[model samples]
Target: MKWSEICIHTTNEAIEPISNILHENGASGVVIEDPVDLTIDRENVFGEIYELNENDYPEEGVYIKAYLPFNSFLGETVEEIKQSINNLITFDIDLGPNQVTLSEVNEEDWATAWKKYYKPVKVSEKITITPTWEDYTQKSSNEIVIELDPGMAFGTGTHPTTVLTLQALEKYIKGNETVIDVGCGSGVLSIASALLGAKDIYAYDLDEVAVKSTELNIKVNKVQDAVKVKQNNLMSNVSIKADIVVSNILAEIIVRFIDDAWTNLVEGGYFITSGIIQTKKQMVIEKLENQGFEIIEINELEDWVSIIALKK
Candidate 1:
């Protein structure tokens, strides 16, 4: 069996919403990423595992998800996903000038072509990601393991945003603390908080994919006991308060979301936010400061940054 991948570029924060739009329109599952991890899960002899896979992309990284039905035409489902996403979804296919793109399937004969791309990724000094099929070796007796397969609603460890989030998490999360990860993509930050010794980690996102992906990832990482993954947009139904709130969102959303993101936190709680480019860092800082959250630390890696603050 084969599937035609539909590549669409949209706001990173909106991918989850778009995935919901696609699922409602008849797409079974979607792979959402900045560089577009077309394949997130790899089949194995034992069962299944999660890992990244290779897909070709030309200029302007995509937040792509492929949808297909065994008996459907490529344009049928593709257009549905496109329409649901509306102007938020833009195509690589340009109608003017002589550019037309055709749908293609994976040339690999093996059913589990995605397995080849599954490999270990370093998340932090004590944490590493391994696909479920592979054995766990070289893990320290006291170290943390976050088992994840590539099939998730959000980007994986390979992305710079995730890496920067992990780095900030390592520094900020601590023992027995109550934490919340707003816009918790794939539940990585919430899982890391649990691993770093947070007791109660409440995570939710606007996308149902985020809720589902986070549930899967929490189980895979064995942090289910510590991490509570739910589907919510900025703490709609969560009754408990948090000592730390971490949000990885676009700068504009960060500015808009901090009001609610902070409302759920305890007075002394820390709010760590990323997905801010250099151009928007100052605006985020000023916004957070205006909210009365003292700026404790700001980390910059490449063009990405994570801001740490305390509710005063």
Candidate 2:
């Protein structure tokens, strides 16, 4: 069987949403090649080795690849994906370059091409994300491991945005606290909350694939009893107050829910948000401040920023 490899050249800010688009359009797996990874200092802690070749990455922006079976409707599907990506501009998402290309490959090639991009990596002080196929053992007593099969879904649990959120969760989530994860892709934040001793976690995502993916991941991490996965648009219908609310989504989407988040948090609750690029950092800060949130901490990794605010 033949497969169609759809490759998109876009900005880091658009990676999560575009990956979701490919998954919803029936792509089996997605591969991301960001030029920034070439310069990341991997000290190879815990004997983990990284094999990255700089030649494969684009000089600027990033390349996102997904595989779909070559079929009669492949062209139509590709066109729809392009239109949907172009539509992101309406939301003020910078899609940098936005050049898309396609190629044909054999099924065998498609099966193994994306595996090399994924490896076990420790994202935070206590949290380590490992691909389901990778063999890794905990190197320390306090290390928490999250096993995931990204499977065309966003949030591999290793992105800087996610890493910052998980790190904050580790620090802020006291035992038995009620937590909410907005735009919970793959349930990584929710799962990390549970692992950190949160008594109850509510995970919400506007995307159906994300909801299902979160459910699957929660079960994989054996935290199904602690985390509840649901499909909801931000906090539109959510009324339950939480001790901590974490959202790793676009800054624009985060701003839209500032009021909702403030209303849904108890006094002194923490609202953690990521997936924000550096340029929009001040915009998000002002919105949070206007909503009466006290800035607690602001974290930056590469061009990504994660803001932690307190509802006081």
Report clash pairs, candidate 2: none
The TM-score of predicted model 2 comes to 0.70
RMSD of 2: 10.8
Residue by residue across 80-141, what tens digits does model 2's lDDT show?
Answer: 99999999999999999999999999977756667777888888888888988889999999
Best by TM-score: 2
**Error at 234, model 2, angstroms:** 0.6
Q: In model 1, which regions exceed 4 Å deviation?
A: 1-115, 237-239
lDDT of predicted model 1: 0.71
Model 1 — TM-score against the truth? 0.64
**Which candidate achieves the best lDDT against the true structure?**
2
**Residue 197, model 1: Cα distance from true site in angstroms:** 1.3
RMSD of 1: 11.3
In angstroms, give how far residue 235 of model 2 lies from its true place. 0.5
Error of 2 at 32 (Å): 15
